[model samples]
Target: MSAPDQLLVVIDAVARRSDGESVRIAKDVLCAGAAVKLCLPDTPAEFAKALARRGSRRPVVIGDDRALVRAVGLLHRGRELSDGALSLVPVGPHGSVDLAGALGVPLGAVAAARAVLDGAARRLDLLVDDSDGVVVRGLRVPAGPSGLAVIEPGSVWDTCRSLVRTLVRPAPSVPTIRTHRLRVEADGRVLSDLDDPVEGVTVLSRGGVAEVVVRPRAAEPVRVEASAVTISGASFRYRADALVTGPVWTRTWTVRPAAWSLTLPAA
Candidate 1:
């Protein structure tokens, strides 16, 4: 599809405080290129309200990855992600916008803004859980190396750099191998049972299935591809994208193929 002419520019308050110059640069580039309506939202409610009233204009978020994730979650829940493509400008401290860069958006304010006006909408797959939570990047066990499982972030590498960060992060102090009691199912097929304590579980969205890796301590990681994955344990938390979520006992995530579209620079 062609680029959008009308744009609803949402400059997150954090972005305004962190990097005013980048935000200004994004505004200059976007306003010069299209008809722009800017919204500087200070709170989550305000942000959602602005997006709700965006009307026919495309929403372009200017902030860090958290802002971008918030925008996506709001759009997805509102069932408007597919109707109107979202754009983003990465403006924040280092590591704050890695998800944006991992998603193939330019990190530079000027470049990202120009892409909003000149780029095309690319449909992407996302993981949607039963609780209506969305995972655009990927997720891992939130408890770290000792408590959670650690497996090679394999195929998830194709879609995000967050996994790369995970790989390069400094080693943890934990020396002994540990395990978490969790039962894992992939497409209704049992990959690991509760009897088999897990060291880690990694789930990443790819195509219409989720690339899943289940690791049991001192054993090789079991990999599978499935349309859905379910994990039930002693109320464990997981990192979805940049957010640490749950204490959820049992959680299920299903892949929605090409469910969302983002305005990205054309290849």
Candidate 2:
């Protein structure tokens, strides 16, 4: 379709602060000379409904990083991402909208909203996992032991006894970082074997390939470019964009080249 003349501005509840700076900036900039439909969604269900009702208007999200992810997930699930260009006006406490900043969206509410009105559409790559989840920034699979620690004691005496035991235990002779055994594949070729312990794995969608980097415990890092990547091992958790998902045994992510477009400042 032709460039969008009307816009659907979906402002997340978190962005609707008492100060209202973000909302005001977005409305003023976007509604200056265009037809705009503004929506304030208090809940996820309301957010979905607002998007579903956005007829031909291009969507502009005004909120933090999570809010951006939510809107993108909805559009991707509905199969409308590729054709519609998205805009973002990140609003929240400082550092809360890092993803938007990383994606080239201006961080200032006024500047971001202005870009939404005056910027150009740039098609960007996306990472789509087997579960149909989308990753906008990147994905990281951490190595070493999971960071979660749990403590349980029957009573105050039990807690004291456990603490005394921990205080008396001998320390290790040599401190070493724990590593995980993972099988990593890129475009069906093995990049890391399960026999090798890995420190971590990072995957990013760049151009038409997935840039895969595998950090081994003792060897030089291995980097490869492929159209897809698959990782299998004991249940492992991964951080995708701004969210953490898994404890999954295996997961595959493929590169969707130029899968969606975003509005950003003109070069």
**lDDT scores in order:** 0.86, 0.84
Encode model 1's per-residue lDDT on 78-160: one tens digit a residue: 98888968899999876788888989999998889888888999988999999998999688874463222234458466546
- On lDDT, the leading prediction is 1
> All candidates: CA RMSD in angstroms?
8.2, 4.9
Clashing residue pairs, backbone N/CA/C < 3 A, model 2: none
C-alpha TM-scores of all predictions:
0.86, 0.85
TM-score result, candidate 1: 0.86
lDDT of 2 by residue, 151-214 (tens): 3345678778878987999766888677888999998999888899898899988777889999
